[model samples]
Target: MGRYTMKSVSLNRLPIGSGLPKICIPIVAHTQEEVMKTAVQVVRSPADLVEWRLDFFDSLSPETVLETATELRQMLHGLPLLATFRSHREGGQQQTDDSAGIRIYHCLMDRQLAEAVDLELSQPADIRRSILSLARQTDTKVVMSYHDFRRTPSQKTIEGILGKMAAEQADIAKIAVMPQTPADVLRLLSATVSARSRLNIPVVTMAMGPLGKLSRISGSLTGSAITFGILDHASAPGQIEAGLLKNFLDELTVDQ
Candidate 1:
């Protein structure tokens, strides 16, 4: 596909693709109190967005998830929240069926609890379409994502996965892969550049692990619109602290 002009995805008024990549910190707590405490710290940190990893919570019940998400949304004030139920197959902390996961997503959207919600690209087409349909009704952004914790795929494969996300009409496309070798990291970055250049929607890509640290901090150069960082803890491998990641991004950002 020919390269297209990059279109920024807005989350709570924040433009994702037009400037230096934004830093998003994950809240991976087991209890409501823990979730609140970490949120407080994230609010005071340099994070531009917060992701609540629902898989880490002890309970996956819709009621529990809804109540907690509602409170976390309020606590964040204006900081954008990206609700994610990372499936175990995709590096999530817990195991969950697709139907349950869909239910949770619907509840969050019904109340407009989050500014954005993650819908895994691995789900069936009908399921993904339903979620995207409701996201439009709720005015919520859909982050269609794919993750491979085993090994980074070939650059072509990486780009193809991102292409699928764009095909689904995702507001944002995200992919995370683990690197078994330094060259693997490069492949992820290379694919990110290609995806960013061709896709109209914003792209978020990362190579996870110590060797993948470069991909996390090199978003500005690779065309990744957002990078995940840690506040109290790391949600994914190789995530730099939010403060440090922000500094690194600032240093690397080119003056437009």
Candidate 2:
């Protein structure tokens, strides 16, 4: 594909997709104390943003989720917070129905608990649209995501998924897939580059597992504008530590 450029989306003053890929660290804690402690550590790290994986929390009630998200936002101290309730089918911590998931999304957005929110693309079409509309109304960026824990799909399938997400008016399109071979990783990166050239929104794509670690570091060169790195713990496989990941990105920038 020819040279591709992605439009940037501002999150709490940080401009994503402007230059080097931003590093987003996830807080997967089970309790308020754990979340607070981890948030403190993340704020001190070189992470560009923070993602609160709300599914990891024991309580899923609207009140508890909002309260926890508010605390996380406060502890972040201006670091853009991304709220995500990844479903179990998508490698998330909780097994929730569409109704429950939508309720949680509304609760978080209504309170402006996070600067951005992640909504899975596999949910019912109406639910996805509703959530996106709610996010827009609240001025919260939406990260429309697709996950494949078993294997990476063909480039065509991946591209189509990205297109679907963009067509939904998502602020960002994200895909994470498991790669069993080196070629699988290449396919993932190629699809990301292709999708980036065709869509207006920024794309975040990753090839999960040890065999796919290279994609995590080199994604910025291809098309992905953001990569997840670990702070206190990892939310996904193949995630490098935040400090080490920052060092790698810095070195790559200088070389380029």
Candidate 3:
């Protein structure tokens, strides 16, 4: 797990901070057929990690989700897995209730279904505590996240949320916000820079939509732990593809 102090924590034994290409592709399918298709795409592409967006599955049933997890595990083999059931507040399916949502999440964690899991920051502290605590028991890395669809907050508020994650022992601090203007984007990036420099956790910061798209590819430049890309398919509204992102990162690579 990442702490408020720089200490190495392995993700499925994959040593991070080595300037390696770590890709996280979102799975936006329902049936086993589509899931398998995405799995094949990952094998053929440069994706370093597979994130099963559980909420995206159309015919998404609990049993089917479990079976798909098992199958995907076999297909993915050693690659790290990320299971996320993002709530409606954070740009995801609004089909599930809070109780059901919490239950399903715990179920996935209990099954040891993935190497990592994504949990929203807006959730109650008791719920967050329970989930993270349970993840620790399974040695599952937790990516505590926050997404702002309205506007970006000041660096102080950003730091406050990230600090809470640090206190909660989050493996990764991921924050995405919607930007209305150029200044909004800067605010988000500035906040990222501060959190990256002071906080002792790997930070993944991005600004969504066209106005905030710059941060998506420039994450690594500003101390972001991960930069998202569409390895095979797009998860969010505005996302660059993996091949294009690799080229972008290569040209922008600054040798310190």
Candidate 4:
């Protein structure tokens, strides 16, 4: 456990990443009030951070997006935000093409509402670096992410993705995969251990779906620093609710 020195990030003054239970509540609202109310629920759920899935913004015009982002940031007050535009190809709501992906990525980063932004690791280095640079303009951290929808990749592949993230100066590296069997879960867990042992940057790793549920619970032990949860609808296809996530993690961390 000493390997992971959980640090705190002050968001307008609220603290994040303080070795405490981080309930990352996902948001999927279209209206300003809807999104704002959801943020309120996030506080009610006692989440450590809020992750706004921008792909869910149905009526989100650029102007509206900026306006909503401003309003959401204000309503959030001090809580840190992690805004993401996960491409549908990567299991997100936005079914965007390459050019469109780049556009949305840049647009979101330019606003600087989020304390951190999640960018697809598969994106070209230039694109990734560009968005990351925008983050720097606002002193935001970049969360480079990789998601394997079809199946889990080999341990070596996972490590490579993490290495790339580090090389790109990512603040956090996240990897998620769908496990077809129990053994797949083991590979993911082992990868987490390997990454933690060799790298210093924080990571968020998980194996999705029913077969991979155990990984979610044992994740903290394996070196996953954050957990993903949804109170109502999941931004991603398969995820447990906040209460369920809290329950599972609680049981896993119980005095063993």
- For TM-score, the strongest prediction is 1
Question: How displaced is residue 249 in candidate 2, in Å?
Answer: 0.9
Evaluation by lDDT, superior candidate among 3 and 4: 3
Task: Tell me, by lDDT, which candidate is best.
Answer: 1
Q: How much does candidate 1 score in TM-score?
A: 0.95
List the candidates ranked by lDDT, beginning with the highest: 1, 2, 3, 4
Model 1, 136: alpha-carbon shift in Å?
A: 1.1
lDDT of 2: 0.86
Per-prediction RMSD in angstroms? Answer: 2.6, 2.3, 3.0, 2.6
Tens-digit per-residue lDDT, 1-256, candidate 3 = 2212243346787644435335677888877899998888876766678788887777556687788888998898787888888888788875676565667667777898888888888889898989899999988898899988888888788878888888889988888888878998898888877887777778778888878768876655566656667865677756778778767766665433
Q: Model 2: residues >4 Å from true position, as ranges?
A: 1-6, 254-256
**Over the stretch 1-256, how does candidate 4's per-residue lDDT look in tens digits?**
3424453344445434334336678888877778988977777785667888887787545777778877887877667788787787787766766565556556666776678888888887788878888878877877789998789999999888887887888888889999988888899999987886677577778888878777766654776777778877776656788888888877776321
- Candidate 1 ranges beyond 4 A from true positions: 1-5
TM-score of 3: 0.91
Look at candidate 3 and give me any clashing residue pairs: 203-225
- Going through the candidates in the order shown, the clash numbers are 0, 0, 1, 0
lDDT, candidate 3, residue 237?
58
Model 1: per-residue lDDT, tens digit, 92-194? 8876677877888899999999999999999889999999999999999999999998988899999999998998899999999999998898888889888
Q: What's the CA error at residue 151 for candidate 1, in Å?
A: 1.2
